[model samples]
Target: MGVQDLLKNLLDWVANLGFWGPAAFIIIYNLATILFVPGSLLTLGAGVVFGVFWGSIYVSIGSVIGATFAFLIGRYFARDWVAKKLENHEQFKAIDQAVGQEGWKIVGLTRLSPIFPFNLLNYAFGLTNVSLKDYFLASWIGMLPGTILYVYVGSLIGSLAQLGMGERSRTSVEWLFYGMGLIVTVIVTIYITKIAQNALNQKIK
Candidate 1:
């Protein structure tokens, strides 16, 4: 099934479980990360089902937990394999050393940068000296803004889906307002992340 269908079915099944439903969704989202699923979709799904406030909360929790789990998996189970693969990787070597001096800042930048590989970075951090607590905190903070932006967009789409666009039809000015808002949000977010990434690269160099 497509992601939306899968999420819709999961939502329906979990809804019948009463108070356990939201918690179950969060757990599922967390576990899905381990499988290398597109967590952005899950975050968007959360916003669709839970609205912006709760969606951001759950996504944050799940993301941090999932990343930490990935870190541990690399540290204990796959360290040897990861090490060998990264042995000749100069970028990997640079990040490792950068993490040594910058700690959470580097981690935070990695989280913000769109070009950074998410799952691999989680594992890569494990080989660094950065503490788990530090990693979690930085990842949480750095990931939050983008999470909010995505969740907000999802919530808007969800609202439109449910309300038939309501007082905001296709020809309405509100549609234009929302369209511009999304475009601006995405551009600003990308710009900021790129700036931060450039600064980080310079620092590491």
Candidate 2:
């Protein structure tokens, strides 16, 4: 099946779990993260299913757990394998060393930006000298704003569908509010990313 079709099926299955849906979502999300799957679609699906507050919470929990597990696997279970995979990538080699020197600051900053793939970063950080505690805290905090922004967008889209796009559509005030919020989120994300990129460059020098 196509990737979208598979994701849709996964979401449908998660939604039908009723009382177990949230728990199932966490497990699925964790597994997906470990499997090197990009989670943007799954994260958005959570927002559609659970609304903003709960969706954000669940995604955060699942992502952290998955990242920790992936890190552990990279560090202990398959270090040689991960090393071989990244050995030719000079960029990642530099990041690996930078993270070792800078600890959670590097981790936190990188998390705010998409300088590297999320799943790969999870494994790459494991290959570094950063402590588990530092990684967990930095990742959680760094990933929060982006998580909330995506979930908020999903919630808005859900609301739009439920309210219908006809005359009963959202008020202009609501539209303005969402628009401003999205703009602010984008600006803040970009600002943090710029800072992170600069820090990364300095560290690499």
Candidate 3:
């Protein structure tokens, strides 16, 4: 199914599950990451289902666990397969070398900047010299900003949907803050990415 349909179905199913919904969402997110599913929709869906704070927390937990799992799979279970798959990825080779020297910094910068594909990078990192502890720590911390921004946007969308249906009320102040927050997040993410990209280039070179 498409992302929206999958998200809609998941929302409908989990909406009635009370406290268990978050757990289920995390598991689903973990599976999606391993399955190579694009996580943008799932992350946004978390905000639509939960709110900003809870959604960010849930997504962070799920994504970190998923990344760790993928890393283990690449390192222990499918090292040869992953190695063969990434052999031609010259960029990954540079990253592997860079990681040997920089360890978690490389992982953190790549995560912050979106310099590499998230799901693939999870597996690819296993081939590097970075420790699993460092990888997990860096991934969680680096991914937080993007997660919060996306979740906030999704929460806003959810609010707008309710507003359209006349099921909820929103104040002008709320809208103002939402707009400002989004703009600030976008700008901050851009600035961070630029710095990360520059630093990563120097390291990889």
Question: Evaluated with lDDT, which candidate comes out highest?
Answer: 3
lDDT value, residue 16 of candidate 1: 65
TM-score of 1: 0.72
Position 52, candidate 1: lDDT: 89
Q: CA lDDT of 75 in candidate 2?
A: 93
Per-candidate local distance difference test: 0.72, 0.77, 0.78
Can you give the TM-score per candidate against the true fold? 0.72, 0.77, 0.77
lDDT of 2 at 92: 71
lDDT of each residue in 23-80, candidate 1, tens digit only: 8987887787766776766676677778889889988888888989988888889899
In model 2, residue pairs whose N, Cα or C atoms come closer than 3 Å (at least 3 residues apart or on different chains), thus clashing, are none
Query: Please, what are the lDDT tens digits per residue for candidate 2 over residues 1-205?
Result: 9665676678778878899999999998899999988887778788888888999999999999999999999999999999998989776765665665567887886777644578998988888889999999999998887677666666766632232233535556557655765665465455545554766787699
Better of 1 and 2 by lDDT: 2
- Angstrom error at residue 150, model 2: 1.1
- Give the root-mean-square deviation of each candidate in angstroms: 6.3, 5.8, 6.0
- Candidate 3, residues 1-205, lDDT tens digits: the string is 7655765677667766898999998998899888788788777677888989999999999999999999999999989989998999876766776676668877886776544689999999988779999999999998887788777766876632232233345557546655765665465455545554666787689
The model with the greater TM-score, 1 or 2, is 2
Worst 10 residues of 2 by lDDT: 159-168
